[model samples]
Target: MTRAKVLLIGLIVLALGGVGYLGFEALGVRGFSAGIAAQSLLVLIVVVWTGSYLFRVVTGQMTYMNQRRRYREVYDAKEREDLEARFDALPEEEQQALLQRLGLDGDDVRADS
Candidate 1:
């Protein structure tokens, strides 16, 4: 697993451990007993919930970051030029439709430059 995934798992573990400690209080666990069994079950629920969310959240973040990175890597002058070249080859009517779809045909659209 990636570092981010590992970190998320570690966070989930710590959260679960905290929940377990809380349960131990409810179950009347003392210093010698350490953990209360009944409360420990509740702790399992917390661990499952948090771990599932952590897995999904961290994975989603990583996927999004990777996608953006890929887009940046592939988005450059050549791609723009290629798109423009293709657009330029189209007839006026088709080009107008394309530009409209791209929001590039707006009459009032102009840079502040």
Candidate 2:
């Protein structure tokens, strides 16, 4: 695995272990009834955080797309049109290849046209 991915997984494991330990300590010191509640709360918080992190991971591409759109929005209309025009000036095959790399090319958008 990649170093970054290995690091991330290691951190996640450590976080889970720390939380579990804390929950167990709270249960032992607080007595059965209160400990159950504390543990429940801890588990709930971890679940929510993990779920949020997973959601962000799953939507990472969409997040990038939103950022790109926002970046384009920062340009004035004339500048945006000029940028588009420059892009359009590229040869059709190159344009299609670029779009394909971005996973955005469709069959209808022929490279030969």
Candidate 3:
């Protein structure tokens, strides 16, 4: 329901109207008696309009999902940083015990030495 989505929907409606008018004109439908050609054109317009609307809906959902994922990533990173800082502030014995419990012994890896 954003302004851009509204504008796009309006544009699509206008395009469908224009195409329907042209179809009617091309079919030479002068009077109230519409033929199969006009009906087929109407169907085509409906199909195209529906497709455009669905596309907008799908893209909007995807954008929302992506935004949510990014926000979660940022939030999780902040939380992790806070947790790491708290862990680092603990005594060495407590830190070592916690790391061992988590299967991350400090003495298990030594690349600089």
Q: Which candidate number maximizes TM-score?
A: 3
Candidate 3 has an lDDT of 0.73
Q: Rank the candidates by TM-score, best first.
A: 3, 2, 1
Tell me the tens digit of each residue's lDDT in model 1 across 13-84.
677666667667667786535455544665677779789869878777656777887788788756877976
The candidate maximizing lDDT is: 3
Q: lDDT of model 2 at residue 62?
A: 59
Residue 110 CA error for candidate 2 (Å)?
Answer: 19
Off by over 4 Å in 3: 2-15, 18-61, 107-113
Off by over 4 Å in 1: 1-19, 31-34, 37-81, 86-113
lDDT of 1 at 91: 94
Tell me how many clashing residue pairs each candidate has.
Answer: 0, 0, 0
lDDT of 2 by residue, 10-73 (tens): 7976676566666777657555645565566667977897899788878774566788877878
Q: Give lDDT per model, in order.
A: 0.69, 0.71, 0.73
lDDT of 2: 0.71
Q: What C-alpha RMSD separates each model from the true structure?
A: 8.5, 11.5, 5.3
Give candidate 2's total backbone clashes: 0
